[model samples]
Target chain A: MTLLDFARGPAMQFAIFIFVFGIVFRLVGVWAMRHKRDLSEPRQPSAWKGGIHGLIQHAWPYKPFRDKLMTDYVIGYVIHLGLLFVIFFYKPHILFFQDIFGFGWPALPNGVITAISIITIGALVIALVKRLTDPVRRLISNFDDYFTWFVTTLPFVTGLATAGNVWWHYETGLAIHLLSVWLLLIYFPFGKLMHAFWFGVSRYTTGSRFARRGGMA
Target chain B: MSDATTTDIPVDLESKRLTVTRPDIRFDKQGELGDDERVQKAMQHFAKDFGYIAANYMEACVHCGACAQACPFYEANPDPKLTPIWKLEPFKQAYKREAGPLSFFYKTLNLKSKVTIEQLEEWQELLYDTCTMCGRCTLVCPMSIDIATLVGMARHGMFHAGLVPHELYTVTEKAEREGSPLGATPKVFADRVEWMEDEHEVDMPLDADKADVLVLMSSIEIQKYPESMAATGKILNQMGKSWTFHTEGYEATNFGMLSGNTQWQKDMTMKIISTAEKIGAELVILPECGHAYQALRWQGANMLGRPLPFKVQHISEFLAEAVESGAIRVNKVDKSVAFHDPCQVSRRGGATPAPRKILEALGVELREPESTGNLNFCCGGGGGVITIHRADSLRYKIMGNKLEQLDATGAEMMVTSCSNCRQNFDDSGEKLHWDKQMNSLLELVAENLVEDTKS
Candidate 1:
């Protein structure tokens, strides 16, 4: 078989593995965290509604309700929004769907994906640089933070390289993607990234747990 | 802990040890804080969940120090170590160890990880003993980070560890054993109300099975601050509202707020719910304990495992509702006084029109503090911390910011809706030397009360 053919089959296999194993690894890590016994009485139906209102009190457009969040929340929002768009909307992701899963859809087109990638990359790089330079982040940051930023960016970068499929032939691109996907998965169950899933569940449970009971959250 | 600061961490205790010594209130049966084998396991659980929420949700914090400007303790002590978030680090470090990847390489990084026995000792002061879970810090975070929620979780961890404040645990023990936090037996609890009945024909009824309102008092009010009960008694009689204070479930102030022990909190809640249900109370009126108001008004339903068989209302709310309903009339006193906002009533309710309406109704001339309503300062107490003498130093330091605002008002009386605030205001005044009459709104209102029908 040609290099492209071999790369395609194995690459497809690894992509499916990453999708399945990566999530499992994340779930395992999250499940390991304790389920706080919501001694907070189970909420009532009306109270559950009140709880929704209570949690909403802290939400963005946070100006009148919470002024403390005024400063960098907008910045954080923009950065995250950009990253989300790029990560999920990239041309290669669309290509992966079409080629690997034979799904039909409108892709971001390569140029738009590339532009979005630059913005996301720029945001992250600035954040990392700021963490390194800022006294507060520097003080609070451990090796894990720096390592997390570096490790998290790998899938993005390798995906970029693999997207171009230009340098070091298709073989190099395929290998890098395979290795990065695996490493990311193995790291999932152990890293801070697992917060993605657990934070929401914990927050909703916490809100539900304490919504109408009495005191504060 | 300087020699001059009597309120500083005590010398009476050479070292801290975990003990749940009050045999009267056995909370072991209510130890339902999930799968933790020990308090440490609970501690670990608290840290992981709290830390992850802070990390991912709070990841974007710029640390611009805006929240520092908001914290009264930060402004008063200026210790930098006492900043709300700084106070959170001991718990945060534990979070890092259990849920952080840094745990994978803890020693290599000098993470200072682990909820060590020593660390738990510091948390006793940091989580419960000092910080009040007032929600001011949460309101100030740039990420809208709920530092207060973490405080709640950490407090639960502390409660699990049996590190509840001595006074509150004592109170809870009394409530559990003697049926009142003050160790007031049903007979004594009834006698206090009975004394009011004997004098001036004023009575706050006890266990009126068909009462419309069930009044729940913190045990402190029973023994030390019966004037509040009398004011409530006088007002209910004037308004002719169907109300009774429970002799058996007389205690509403839960130690869980102080200790973070969910079981005790739950049990306390059950007592209130069952009492309210027994009396067929349509409305449950919580006395002026700020946290207690939040506990029953907001949280009691869930802890009861269903909607409370009755509606829970704060005394302020009840009084406010009465005045609004035109059942009672207030002649705003011919006086200008500043209102000290209880953190729970102000922030939790998101409005203060009720008491303000009461003040205006009382004919009391009102002078607004520069910070009033939602922006009003914390009364330097809440979260059951004021009872911890060891936390007094930090507590009073935080009180300075509040005092400054009171002084700004130049109002003769600092009217508040909470007993905890009243107590803390008194505690702070002894040092700050402010002579402002720290009055409970209900007490003050009931004293000047005129019947709306008569008017």
Candidate 2:
């Protein structure tokens, strides 16, 4: 089979299977763990409200922390928004999603998606630079951190290269992009990328626990 | 803010520097256990602490290291190893190896190693000394990981391993054996109460056969700040509340909770629970202590394996309620004061507004720090760090951040409800040569209490 055909066929199917199976395995594993029931009377009646509050509260930096982490926070938001728009709003990506899910929404202009992708790539690069240079980040970062960064950034770079027709054959570039995408999907459920699913749990636990105690969430 | 003096308490600078000498910890059982046994016990305890919340926290950490910025130890010292998440390295290792969902993968792949005795020894400082478990890191984490809770869990393992700091362990052992970490036994507490009655001319009641309210005091207040006991009596008497100080459950401070001894924590909590139940107390009022409020108000029920029969309120919350309801009145103190929000009481316990409300009722100008209420910085002495003699320099360094925040408020005096926080401020202020007097919210109200005109 040609490289593009292999990328589009068996590799894609296997990647999809692993992604689904692994995520469910992880989610169920986490959910099935022992939960210590808080028997104490709650100061606030509604814990779910606190959970929702926490989900949103963590989206922005607390006031005192904002100025100190301004650059990092900005870069983080940029990278996330860029990945979001490029992955779901780009016409080809939406069409790809439509192929799998049997539905699609109006796609953003290709130019706009491309610009966002580029900006996201820039943010990812800055994030990488900060990770490598910042003392605390560098000390705490392990293989999972750097590897996830590479895994996340590769598809953006390869997709841009393929679409922009930048110094590569279209078939070859597309195959590389597809392969990178598959690699990300396979790794998503295992590595730090799994934060996508667990951040909510973390936030909800904190928000609810604190709110129940009448603490600021 | 105006610099009108709030109190005439003279600054006591002639005292020696804050003690950093390590107390000899009695380790009868721990001494008999081998290193491997300690490690095994630590691993077992860590596994026991494993639950859905801890599992999610471990999985959710993205290594963003934003928690470092929020940590006072890292902020003051700028040491990468002092980063809040880094403090949990060994705990995370234990979790991944023994309890995580992918534990099989981790063990088979050898992704995480078993925690060694040496690592535990090295981590004693990181877990017990440097960290205050102030929950600031938990607040600032982008992933919302409750790093503070994990730290507390890690302490359970550390305690089981007999790796707690000497001073903290000594205090915990004391609280376990003597019921008061500072030697404030039943007899001493009675004497102090009697003394306070004579000294302050307040109607101080001893253990009552049955009462609606049970007033608990920290050993620190009993030994160092006896005025707190008098202040509590004055207020209760003025309000005509049926309250009595029960020697059995008098200790509000729980060094066991501070030192991470869960069993001892339960024992300490149960003492209060049973005592309050014995008296048929409708409410138990915690003294000017932060951890005591947390131990009894929040963790008391969970430790008892059932909900506590009686309600618990911190002294600040009680004062706030009393003043708000006009159950008691206080003469207005015409002075500007900055209120130091205790980490456990305000930030962690959710009594952030209680002290403020009391201050407002007293007609004092409240000069709020930039980081006030639940967002306030810790006094660098919570979480049993105050007792760890080895942590003094680091604790003092961390106090710099709080000092700056408080100084910026430009309030003439500082008032706080937590006796532990007040002691830290007094000690640090003395050593740092900061002239601001650390006043007590309870004392402030007692001194300014308006007499009942009808009487």
Candidate 3:
């Protein structure tokens, strides 16, 4: 089979398997652990509402931290929002989604997606520089942090290169982009990249806990 | 430390100099536990606490470091090691090795090594001394990881390992053994209550049978700030509430919770719980103590493995209700005052409005700090940090942030409801030469109480 064929068939299938299995395994592993029930009478009465509130509230920095970490928050938002746009709003990505989920939504123009991609790549680069320069981030970061950054940024770079036909044939660039996506999928459930899913779980837990205590969750 | 003043010595022709030294604050080792035993105990306890909440929190950290800026220790020292989440390194290590989904791989690869005795010793300061469990980090975390709760859980492991700081360990031991961390024994408490009753001319009830309310006092209130007890008595009396200080469980301070001794925490909580049950109390009013409010109001039921039979309200909450309902009237004082929100009671305990309500009743001009309510800076002395003399310097440094916030308010006087926060402010203020004094909300109300003389 050709490189693009193999990449689109076996590698994609393998990555999907690992992604599905790993996520399920990781989630079940956490759920299987003992859960201590909150038996105290809730000051706010509804834990689930608190949990839902927490999930949405943590999307931005707290007001006091906003000015101090303005650059960090800006870059973080840019990178996240950029990726979200490229994934859901790009035409090719929409086609891929339609192939998998059997549904499609209208796509944003190529110009907008390209602009978002460039900005996202810029933000990703800045984020890496921050991880390397800032003491607190440097101290807390590990192989997981750097590797997740690379895998996350890789898809954007490869997608952009495939679309622009930079330094390779269109088929070859597409295969490379596909492989980078596969790498990200393979590692998503195991590394800190799993934060995409677990962040909401944690926020909900804290929100519910503090909400029950009548805290500003 | 020594002053420039010289002393006259008869034997010597020249004057001699006198030198003074600060009190020695050192770690006191617990029983003859071996390193292996301590490590074993710590790891086992860590595993026991590896529940869903912990696992999710641990997994959720994206290393954004937003929590660092929120942490007063990190802000004061600007040290990466003082980062709030970094303090949980050893605990996270234990979790990954023992209970995480990748536990097998981690164990086989030795990726996360077993927590060593030396590591536990190093973390003693990080887990206990620097952290106040204030929940500021919890509020600021983008992932909502609840770093404060994890720190508390980490302390449980540290306590089991006998790796707690000497001062904290001693205080917890005292509370566990004598039922009071600061030696406010039942006899002492009764005598103090009697003294306050005579001194304040309020009918202070002690060990009353079948009272509707059980009033709890922190050891600090009983021993150091006796006026709090009198103020509580006065408020209850003015409101015509049947309240009594039950000697069996009068101490509101929970050093067990402070020092991370789970059994001791449960025992201390049960003392108050059983006392309220015995007295057939409809409500249990916690004193102006932050952690005490936290220990009893939030964790008390969890400790008892069920919902508490009696209602728990922080003194501020009770006072707020009384004043708002006009059950107790307060004569307005013609002064503007800044209210210091205690970390645990206001930020963590979720009674931020109660103290403000009391301030409104007193009709003082409430000058708010730059950061108020849930986002207020800690007094640098909660979570039993004030009790540890070794942390005094660091605590003082962190207190600078609080001083600036309160000072910027430009209020005439500052009032706080929690005795622990007041104690911290008192200690820091004295050493810092700060002119403003920290006042207690309950006492403020007692002093301005509009007595009910109606037949």
Candidate 4:
């Protein structure tokens, strides 16, 4: 009865499959590249102490894992927290996912959700701008990096348009968001940003090897 | 004692400086390099090697300059020409001129304009002499291309091309012939051990075959740093622990850290491991040399092709180990002194804490500057960069970075865990007008020695 049903063709299904499969391939590649040399540790008394020290340094003044407080890892915490709220609780997302999986959490109130969404969108934009404009951060970014920036912004632009509730415009934004999410999933496994999944294993391996020694002497 | 009374390599307790007025040094003019025919052939060889590495290893750089930001020397200087990529140009051009895609035109038109004797000398100064090849740049390289490894390979190729530096070759040649860089044989090392035993009535064993500890010191200690070596002998004797100094394996200073010549470094490391294994020592303790600590600590197992069966500890680590194990006792230094972070001890080996721990054990008040540990600034002597005569100016510049921190510490003296760092600090401190005294962990530990009669 509505155009919303028309956009739900099988082409979207293929895109979803590519996204999930791409993530798996990335995990396999990173794991395979790790520690080609079977490394050994020299026994030291303070190895574990060193790992604890390093972890503390990384998370210092910012409880990054569970808190939304801006004091710790200011940029990292702010952007990621804003992103989580937007991706999972935006009204259009809840309705779309509710249809896809037949289950959904209550969406945040429309005004509150959009407010949070705009804040997140702003943070991400600043981050992308920083990467391009900042001399040091720009030098460190790569081809895959720019690709991530472009694709992320596309979802937000479409979602804002779809938010007007202008007769099926919401469905249009939902479709764009889903497609972007899928593309990101697929690209995840191929890039240096793959470090997200890979770094845990790398850190743990480095930690445990040196942990047994109590940290480097 | 006055500077006039100080020996050629002085042990001046008064000025709290090692007053060594070392002869002016150069690394390029030695060997078959001086002969025109050999130099020409060397040039051909240089061109080929430089061409191969640049095309194969360097051609892919995005020039993002991320690596330049990582390099401490580049960060300190901010000069584009001083950057790692630009540093390779002179060498890379040598390759382009000899065997590059357009070498034919170069050959016809004497396209060798890109390669020159003075340019070669300048590259030698910048790449070999000034640049420490610290490898920090490689970590920041998105390509993960290890510029330091490339530089070392370049050094090895340069050696094969007969362009070895006299500064390191002079030491390596001595090490090759005498089993010590001081031109001392096993007899000289043994004699020092004997002298320690007689003076202190402690029977410090020589070639204590199958001892539990293989104590390796540098030529600096054997020849000039005796008060420190005496402290070591004192500690080992007090512990009554199983330890020996291998007369043959006496020198632990690996030139790999200097020249980045991996094979030669491997040869030097293997000698220590074999000496330790032969003596059946469970511990291989490296004395106070920055690059020596790195070669053994970071590169030991790789150089040996397996896990080092014996443990490697820096002298500071060993001293801290002794303090931890209750083998040696020390009195408080009782004066405020700052610690200088050696690039090897702090950054490369991650052994910064051991000295701090030992200094704490001695109750020496440690006055730290803003940046002390792994984020440490270099002491200007690493990567064999100290020996290039042209870098005398740069040496003063970098050392001034340390001297500024030393000034801020407001301390009477500075203690470091490296001989070269101490050497650089002592020489440059006096030259650069920084009033603070510069000394080593060994010298401080020696002066604070408390003979643990209990052990």
Question: Which residue runs does candidate 3 get wrong by more than 4 Å?
Answer: B1-25
Chain B TM-score by candidate, in order shown: 0.83, 0.94, 0.94, 0.79
DockQ-best of 2 and 3? 2
List-wise, what DockQ does each model earn?
Answer: 0.11, 0.80, 0.79, 0.05
Per-residue CA lDDT of model 4 for B256-327, tens digit only, reads: 546544567888888898999998988888888877876787677877889888888888888888788776
Q: Whole-model Cα lDDT per candidate?
A: 0.63, 0.85, 0.85, 0.62
Candidate 4 has a DockQ of 0.05
Which consecutive 10 residues in model 2 chain A have the weakest lDDT in total?
Answer: A163-172
Model 4, docking class: incorrect
Candidate 4 lDDT for residue B371: 55
lDDT of 3 by residue, B1-455 (tens): 01111101011111111011222534444656788998998998888889998998998889988889888888889989989999999999899888999899889998888888988888888988899988888777888888888999999888887777666676677677778776678998899999988998889888998899999998878777899988888878878788899899899989898888889999999999999999999999999989898899889999998999999999999999998998988999989999888888887888999989989888999999988898888877888677666677889998888999989989999999988888778778878888988999899999999988861
| Tens-place lDDT digits, model 2, residues A154-188 | 99999988879883578878999999999999999
User: Which regions of candidate 2 are displaced past 4 Å?
Assistant: A166-169, B1-30, B453-455
Candidate 1 CAPRI grade: incorrect
lDDT (10s digit) by residue, model 1, range B426-450: 7677877776658788888877887
Superposed on the true chain A, the predicted chain A of model 2 yields a TM-score of 0.96
